[model samples]
Target chain A: MSFIQTLKQSVGLSTDGLTKRKTVTFGDTTAVGNGRFWSIISVITLSMAWYLGSALELVNPIFWPAPSAVWDQFINISQDGYRNFTLWEHVWASLYRILVGFALGCLIGIPLGFAMGLSEIIRGWFDPIVEFFRPIPPLAFIPLVIIWSGIGERSKILLLFFAALWIMVIAARAGVGSVKLSKIHAAYSLGATKRQILMHVILPNSLPEIFTGMRVAMGICWGTVVAAELVAAESGIGFMIMAASKFLATDIVILGVIVVGVIGYAIDILMRKLEDKLIPWKGKA
Target chain B: MSDLVVNDVSMVFDTPSGEQVHALENVSFSLKQGELLSILGPSGCGKSTLLNIIAGFLAPTDGTVELASTEIHGPGSDRGMVFQQGALFEWLSVAENIGFGLTMKGTPKDEIKKTVDHLLETVGLHDFGEKAIYELSGGMQQRVALARCLANDPDVILMDEPLGALDALTREKMQGLVLKLWKETGKTIILITHSVEEALFLGERLFVMAPRPGRIKKEYSLPFAEAGVTKDPRDVKADPDFGAKREEILNMIWEMEEEIMGQAEE
Candidate 1:
């Protein structure tokens, strides 16, 4: 039988004489917890709150940037551009840097993390170096990155790679370490090779932690992209914010922050969805 | 029944402090291939050590164990070991755990599925092959562990108090299942236990060991297992030689323990 047939049979959908077919009836309360209506209602309520607060002058309209101010600023920036850069150009530049840095971090960090997790010798050598650099903020490295790589796109990406590497490596290492020795022993007792054990035992066990780290990295990278642009950039949202501030275009600054928030929130939500789809056996662990 | 001979096996564990503690001292015994034998002793006895040595997880300091013409050195597919705790892989489903040995041997996926299905039925977990290890009861998990071991169809099954962790009720139920499985498979089984009554009910011949510098002190040949099995073995306990053997073993263990303590103090 195929996988689906096997699954169906195990759940007692097989044509067995002793199978019990019980029907479950849902109550009205189930719909409330379904989340669809709740989400729409929350969004509407938040929008109304933003409008009312601006109308009432409860928050200073300049610093807070009322919805109308932010909307007008968005259209103006899209149409006329800022510092020889269109809004889309800035968004694309920042997004590209984030993706490249994240991919690079994962490439280098994950294997090193696994090595550190599995071998005490690796942990002993690398842990001190990790700790020494980890406390210094990624923004602090901005000066050296600019000097070494020049104030080009490369420096901005290197900043992000620096920001993300330690977090991913540590989370990955922790994830691998948390896997029980019994699981490894089980594979060994069954005569699985070392590579086989790492692929099946270590990788699967480390997945939940890896997903968690990715979510955090995405959030952190959103902030880092802006910081990366602050030092020197001909394009990007961070460059837009710094340039707008010189002209006292406060509305543009708030708009840039909100865009960052929205992007961060959307990416985090996607990360959660990926977690749900990948580790479908949550009820077991 | 292939005879298992332990030719002068002694297991002396050397500590980092340069002191040697004997876990098994020149222990020798032969087991009928399919006979269910239990080794009973006090807490510090070498009962489990003997099983571990036979499983090839540890080597005996001064002897060898042979299954017919084959000498056992390392854990192999021919000897299956069931630990006290059912060490089921958390991520693998019941069928996957059972099929693990086949997967390691590079057996085709389809053959693995068939063998896993057959073992699941044999272990009386016919419908649970897809369920997670955590979803099963303590008893059910042990059953899956057994099926996993049996998937390789080993000649001898070594159990180091496999039912020791269960509650009394589950333990009794598991005991019944073990006897049924033994009867069906006719596989040689070496059971290590601390419970005298459990030993009486499981072992055809009870081997008694002492704790200090642990060694096999006595071997009692008996037809107790079949008689003591069905919960009406009160009279079997009162058999002329049964009480005498138990008392003699108990006295020997006590003497050995004191001597060991004296040596340790010095």
Candidate 2:
């Protein structure tokens, strides 16, 4: 008998097999379960601070409008249409550009990244081109994309795509390269084909990074959408903000900024949820 | 039915500076079906390099590895390997990691699930099927790695210091587990480690390798491999021949180490 096994058995605990069975406690009636208490306390504290801040006028009132004033502006914008576009229309255009561009980026970048990950030859061929092009920011491509695709939806979408693609490429490269060699061998010993090794062993192992890439790409997607609108758009939040800036309407510009922030936050939350769903093992990470 | 024949195997790796470094040379060995052989050596003795070649992850420059009269050119499910590091897929659950090979081979989902559960149970991790790799401690992660390898049901299990990362207590426990599993599964096992005590305790025959183009310097048939040898590990360690054999192997390794380092200086 092993020394530890004797000791554990002496105490009536068993460690006879490959695993030791143990019981664990979860968040049933613990301090972590006090959702109501936490929710109420946070709201109370935030409201008190807001009330005090409004009375003192501590920040730029026009730009950092009071929460209640911002709420009012939100409702007002929904009610009032501007130049054949409501707040929702502006939101839709911005979100459309981001989703389309981000999707295009994934379509191009994911395959390219895996190709580079699989073979040194592919990496050697592409690394130079990627390094040369990636250093220049996607917004910098605005002038060039305009020259080629014109200042239309194509140019705007391409700008967003280019921005998101570089980030995804970097993330994917890291993911694939980081997969352990032993895992690949393990798969090979299991009669896995080359494609099987990549799809099952390499790809699944690197999912944490792949999801990180998606999150980073989506964030870049939003920023690119805003930049794309700033250059040429009649109907995005960036256009709305720029148009409002011309009229010295700081409240409207702040509203546009708020809209962009909320949209970015919402989509990021969705991506996190998707990551959790796809890789339930993420909690370990 | 599954047996290994490694014939006059030798391996060499060249440094980036183009210097040829020998790892193994003229190392020949063969294992009968279900034989458990342990390789004990000093560090840098190419034990792992030899094992990798057998696993088909590396190619021997001067010899061939044949399994059941077939030349081994690449990895197959016929030769499972357990790395010192667990290397479980971080993003996969224990069951998914265990079933990975099956999934890759297009096994039916139900069959894969059944085999994964059976494997988890065999490895004594039945309830850990849903757990993630990181959720387990070091020893437990190694068990998960074991289950993953066994789930593939290979003809041979090549372990390269599989318990080297664990604490002393866990390593001993895992050694027992490995022996028990090897017996029950009836698979040919080739284990490589630097620990003398481990080799004496676990191996039917111990192969002592020397460094600097590692070659099998001595093959010791230990008393523990005798049918009279006790199953208890402590008893095996306490056997009269244990200390003498350990000393002899240790001296042989030390001499090789001095020779290799001297060669490097020259």
Candidate 3:
């Protein structure tokens, strides 16, 4: 088959006859063409390839440690500790910083965004400042943060906070701005006070967008937290990785990288689940 | 005494390029208590502008709208509006939507529930109260919109092409519901529509309007709406007078459109 045909078939879009079947019936919970099954298969295949390549010495162990070596390093770190802090300590420290920074961002950013969305004067006042700083990388603030706050937890948390705030503000504003004029008119005609409209109509309608912005902010916060820790931190996953790299402990570095990725992925999944619960009517309308 | 009076209402909108668009000009009318007034016109006739002005969503450049001898200022629960589309909050259930106005007014929870339940029944949506707005069909959604508007027990209901989006069968059914609601509640209603049949069938007092400085061209006091209370809408439409009035209005609108096109060409 041609590449385009095969691609279409893979997506279940090629067959005209199948397209006519509106009702979908699954044979079992573990369907062959299910997305979860494909994901598992892909992960297994990649792991096998990594194991084989390392076992055959296709890559130098010094540069790219074997999966087993990385696994051993992970176990060792939990028991023996890395740089006087255990694996749990490093993970907890990073989690604390991220949580604090993200919480602060949401607290201020959400209201600011709503204000900008609601009033032209507020939007005009903040638009320039938000736009000017939004495009700059969070890492770019490292030097100034270090100079101002020193290499303390405050600087690290502040960096993550900045990363999350801009994303949240923009999200909230966009969400508020997008509410249909007709809906507002309906509210007004129904004799809603300005306060009532703000609470009942604008807030609920803007929630989906706010939730989306939160998810994006979370991803950015996670990335920024690690970079912040790498720049200057006594204990964190980023610190562990940085420490390991300096000593040429490739296995520990790999383990730290995997841990960071797994934690970030887990946080994203949690956020998505919360979004589904909070905004159940998001796409339905 | 009139329930609502609109006197010398005019709206002029200035575009960004310094051009003025006259949306409505010298539009004057008075609606009696419990009367159904339908404003019919071609697309740009500013019928919607007039409705918005009455609803207090917009301020007319000139003139006053008085309800019960008091001048209108801003939107209040006294005047309820049903938009062309349902304009319902998608996140809210049918019952919640109906109760929104009551809730805003700080009505007791039990009273809100009772009123909303009654409204749901009146609109024939008793079973669908718990259903989300999006779950219902277009016709059902409009029914909920009507129920929501009526829940407030406003002195006047302003509907801007409330059934414009419905299919032909549903539109006819909704028109009947409007007539029923008018008879039952005795609330004054001003419905704006582009449909000549809908205007004649639902309106006892009909205003035919022309665009290009949107103004009322003619007014008719028709008996079809009264006849429709007892007779089938189709039967009412079949009357010779209904045909003659429809043809006359259709020609008037056609001439207005032609004049607009000729001006555009220039």
Candidate 4:
């Protein structure tokens, strides 16, 4: 029997006389089909409509460039390049800043989070700083970061770092805080020392939360890098698109958007895959 | 010999509203080295608070818990605890969880393996040593918890409703396993449970507690736990004396619950 029907019957609702409707409800697990098929179909249909509309000049080419025009812009930039640097250079510049800033954030934020979660004193000292800055957008910091560091690579990377730092700290702290009191007590009663309990019980337990935080931090870093580059930076995808927008190079702008979106999506997918492999017991417990 | 002693233990919680809640009041008991004691009480009766005090997880406001004549200042390996659920490390396999205490103490790998294997067999989970905690059924998880607690070879084993989450059949079988392990290992056990029949069947000595300044209201020494070792628990529970005792304790707890409810309404 279907789960909903069984539930209804158990709750004393008459399933005997009523006609069974083969329809999906919001919470019906059995009704949840593989959504991937629909996702692919929607993408295909949208692309066809876009291509057909562009080919027939349904709208001005300046405002909504065709996919083919974007493709051509991609090839044009790949060869002759956007500005003096090649296409890869712009992509590489953005990626390098994100990786370096994100790496620095994780390096500092994770330990800081651990400290905060483990000690009341540390939490009290740092809580104000984190909580104060957490809600403010990375874009808000761009102006201050530029003023402090100037419109250089340091400014862009620093903005990305700040964007990621708060998220990683919160994630790591939550991971440590989420450890069950029972698990800790059990470990202690099992004769584990404080250090051993931290290493074995608390660390492993917090990994799922940490992974989730990393994913969120990476995504925010991607967005912050672009915004930072948009505001400043001489070379990056954001710079490329901003430079193109000046001359109404809509095709190049579209190309840049697609590339950034694809990479952002790919990074999230990769993080999810890594999370699955490393922490198979993520939500089970 | 009295291996464990609770000396005038009382736990008073101060609410944020500046109200003092007497969770436990002047509770005291002592157990022989291999005795099985089950504590039965309604909700908010400080049964768990008392157990936590004994386990050294909580410091009672005005008492001391000593095991083997030494005061328990904090949680140590000499005392093991099995919780009802979610106490096992989800990241670790069944064997890893069972051998966790030994590993923490830096025991040799071969010895940990040997002990873990033996415990797997003891708990009837011999083939499930490599399985993750989430993959196991609720009953199997509790078995893992039991084995994990036993692996420590502690002087006392404290269980807080260890089989509470299991279905009826699983709970019955686990109760039998508890009796068997208690008999074979000869370790002192103090189990807190809500089920009256469970208390009667598994506890050689049963303590029924009252709420609102939780204290031991009555104690009964039963033959059912020993009798349950060799014979079927069902048959032992069917005895007239067992039924009579179960009824009396049930009535006592029911009255206490009623009084607490009536007070709450007032």
TM-score of the B chain in each candidate versus the native B chain = 0.87, 0.93, 0.97, 0.98
TM-score of each: 0.78, 0.85, 0.92, 0.93
Global local distance difference test of model 1: 0.79
Candidate 1 Cα deviation (angstroms), residue B162: 2.7
Supply candidate 3's per-residue lDDT for A243. Answer: 92
Candidate 2's clash total is 1
The local distance difference test score of each candidate is: 0.79, 0.82, 0.89, 0.92
Residue pairs in clash, model 4: none
Number of the predicted model whose TM-score against the real structure is largest? 4
Candidate 4, B138-220: lDDT as tens digits = 99999999999999899899999998999999999999999989988999999999899999998999999988899998999
Give model 1's DockQ, 2 decimals. Answer: 0.25
- Give fnat for candidates 1, 2 and onward, in order: 0.25, 0.82, 0.82, 0.96
lDDT assessment of candidate 3: 0.89
Whole-model lDDT, model 2: 0.82
Model 3: how far residue B136 lies from native, Å:
1.4
Task: Give candidate 2's error at residue B125 in angstroms.
Answer: 2.2
| Model 2 alpha-carbon drift over 4 Å, by segment | A1-71, A280-285, B108-114, B225-230, B264-266
Model 4 misplaced regions, further than 4 Å: A1-29, A35-37
Error of 3 at A284 (Å): 2.5
Worst 10 residues of 2 chain A by lDDT: A25-34
The deviation in Å at residue B176 for candidate 2 is: 1.2
lDDT of 1 by residue, B1-266 (tens): 46788889988887899988788888888877788888887766788788877877788879999987678887666777676663676667889989887888899999999999888888889999889887888888889878887887778888778888788888777777787788778888888876665776678878888776787777877676666555445577678777776677677667776876896799
Worst 10 residues of 2 chain B by lDDT: B222-231
